[model samples]
Target: MASLKERITRLQSSALFRGMTRESLEPLAKILNEESHKAGTVLMDMNAPGDKVYIIEKGRVRVSRVTSYGEETTLQELTAGDIVGELAPLDGHMRSAKVTVTEDAVMFAVSGEEFEQLLKSNHDVSYNLLRELGDRLRRANDNIISRLEEQRVNIEGRMLRLHKLTEASKSINSTLDLDKLLTRILEAATSSLDADRGTVYLVDDIKKELWSKVLQGSNMAEIRLPIGKGIAGVVAETGETINIPDVYQDKRFNRDFDKKTGYRTRSMLCMPMKNKDGKIIGVFQLLNRTDGAFTKDDEEFIDALSAHASVAVENARVAQEMVQNERLSAIGRMASTIIHDIKNPMSTLRVYAQVMKRKSGNEEAGKLADEMIHQVDRFVNMTQEILDFTKGVSSLNIVDLEFGEIMNSVLDFIQQDLEKHNVKLLRETQFKGMVKMDQDKMVRVFYNIASNARDAMPNGGSLTVRTNEAKGYVNIEFVDSGTGMPDEVKKRIFEPFMTYGKKHGTGLGMAIVKKVVDDHKGRIEIDSEMGKGTTIRILLPAA
Candidate 1:
């Protein structure tokens, strides 16, 4: 046992006595009773009385609470020079958490009444205790902030991963080329999971093997493995995700490939890609992860991404086949139509040339020459329309032109055709402001509409062309008093390969008009009845 003087020295060294004067600590130290507790001893129980405060002199103590399941969860650990039971003494409440001696410990215990009296009598002792309590509160606040920061970081990481996966899916789905699609999928998978390299192996069901379609890190030729041969093969065969932290330790991992490629294998993540029918299409194999081994979260993310990849692969395969078949069909139809249409004009031109050669300087020779010129013009127009339809609207020569001027130019170009068809023309204008548009394309739009109107009226009818400005848009309307169209014909009028009643019609006129309007960010509305007439309205943004 130590002397009272030694006990006084120990008390003065404690955190609660940090700022106390020598005179203030001497009397408190003499009244404190020295206590000893062996390891595993319970110092206090929860909801117990608040009678004394204990300051640890040596050894460790654990503060814990019993959960509803009867399991003890440690809140904190205290060592020498720390104090417990101080909160109970200050508030006169039962112990909030139980304290136990984790190691054989000696402590100085002081009664609550005697401790309060000492604090009241000594101003230095009171200030020291208050300061110690404030320090504990700051430490508690710091712990809470640390925990919140960790949670925030975890949530942000999860959000970023989800965003990357979504973007990868979109990119993979956009391409129809199998090789390009596979490359993009592998790149996205390895990068999202922080893997060094990756490979996409598609299963060859007919051959009972798996073949690599895309390998990220190596320039080696395509590698083929039998089903159930390697890690990837096993996943493809069983349709399970395998995350191996050490590739060498796993019996499923094949070492021959590593030896041939001169690349040391460390870790691997292999998963099977399944289509909507639940049939495995391919296997995604990721090499060693950059940060560490792949986790459960990585497995879940890869599984979701693989589902999208499987659908994309199947779609690309089907789309490629469809495109090839369409190309062949289009080529056959275009060749046959061109040969049949041009043969008549060619025959007519050849006959007119022979007649001109024989009847030189005759009155009928001039008339025959004019007719020949007309036939050539018709043939050129037919060919030009076909070329325009195939080229598509890729670039536009945009300019600001007055709406009234554009309408006048279009009407003048088609006035002769209207007269030839005996169709009366009616023009109406409300505004003459300039509109930002592609001039040539806009002219083609009006030309196609006017030509369609001429074909509709074989006998004679009225053709109304009007322009107005309203709601910040320039509206152009072409209403014709000719044989109109039915509801079904009007509905599909703007679709390619749809024509109601016309000979030598490629069925691309209205489709081209709609494409031009859409490219200019404009709208087109058509209203037609079987006998009443047709009204085609175009709205373009006013400049």
Candidate 2:
């Protein structure tokens, strides 16, 4: 057995008894009892009332919590010279975590009441305890802040990647040219992903091979590989996105291309481009990320990029087909016009020739000759009109002419056509002033509008033409009580070859009117509703 003085020395050496003087420790030495726990012994149960404080003097002990799933999670391991159960005595509460003996252990145990009395009697002991508790609280707060900062960084990275993907979609969708569209797609992929090099391989279904159109860093001849030969080909065949940290280690990676080009390949990411119908169309591959190996995030980003590129490729192909169709249509319309215009003249010529042959001996033969001459004149005039229209309005005989008189002449020229369609015309002019213009071109503008109105009101409708002179400008408006245009047609009304609801229409009338207006430095405005009426307003600078 140890002597009283020896026991007192051991007590003062403990962490809990630190800073206590010999006089203060004398009472604790007598009250503290030496206790031993066998290995695998439970010293205290969590949530149980604890009235004693234990200071470990030998061996190791584990502190742990039992989870809701009934599994033990070790909170900490404490060895000799450490203190446990001290917090419970200070707050007079139950144990927070269960304490178990991992090995045979010895501890100094003191009742809660005795420890409280000792703290009150010694100011140094109380001060030391407060300092230790403060340190533990600070460490816990630092751990919490570290976890929150990590979460915030992850969120910011996701948002930045999403923004880049959205911008890439917009850039590729803006163009219909195949060359420019493919170039932009490759540029966007390499830059956004921080790739050192990239290439886009489109699958040629007819040839049953993969062909590259755009490859970064070198202008090589088109690369063609069989459908199952290389890594990119595999991705195209399988419709899978692959990320390889070490391209050399993969057996499927082809090294012959690298040797031929004198380029070293490192990391690789290959993704399949699929159309909206979910059919694989191409493969996009990137090599050697600038920072490190490509991760799961890079795979997700590239997958989204490939989706947009697929749609853009399809759109460009469709637009090209439409352009080809328009060219063929223009050729057909030109041939038809030439044949239609010359047919009536040819018919009149045949009729007069037959009459002249049969009436050769008649008294009225001279009168018939005069009629044939008149018909020849009409044929020449028809050919000249067609030639003028095809030549466009190049020579503008610009001169000062009364605005009201020009309007009257345009109305009279289209009067017979208006009567044939049963359309009424109303004219209102507030200006009789002379305006600088090419009379022939201005008359053509009025003729086109009147013809359009007449066609719109097949049964019958009123047409109104109004002119007004304002400060330094003149305004002419054509309003018609005819079937109006839909929003889609109205938006593209001035584009050449855009027409609706007319069988014999060439769709060039408004386009020509716009050209004339622009040459004179003027503006045109249109207002219409589907079921309501249509209005066209033109503004010209005053002479």
Pairs with steric clashes in candidate 2:
none
Give each prediction's root-mean-square deviation over alpha carbons: 22.2, 22.6
* TM-score, one value per model: 0.43, 0.42
Please, what are the lDDT tens digits per residue for candidate 1 over residues 397-510?
678888887778668768877998899888887769999898767777888899898888888898999999979999999999889996657866986667877977767779
Off by over 4 Å in 2: 1-133, 215-221, 324-543
Point to the candidate with the largest TM-score: 1
Which candidate comes out best when scored by lDDT?
1
CA-lDDT, candidates in order = 0.82, 0.79
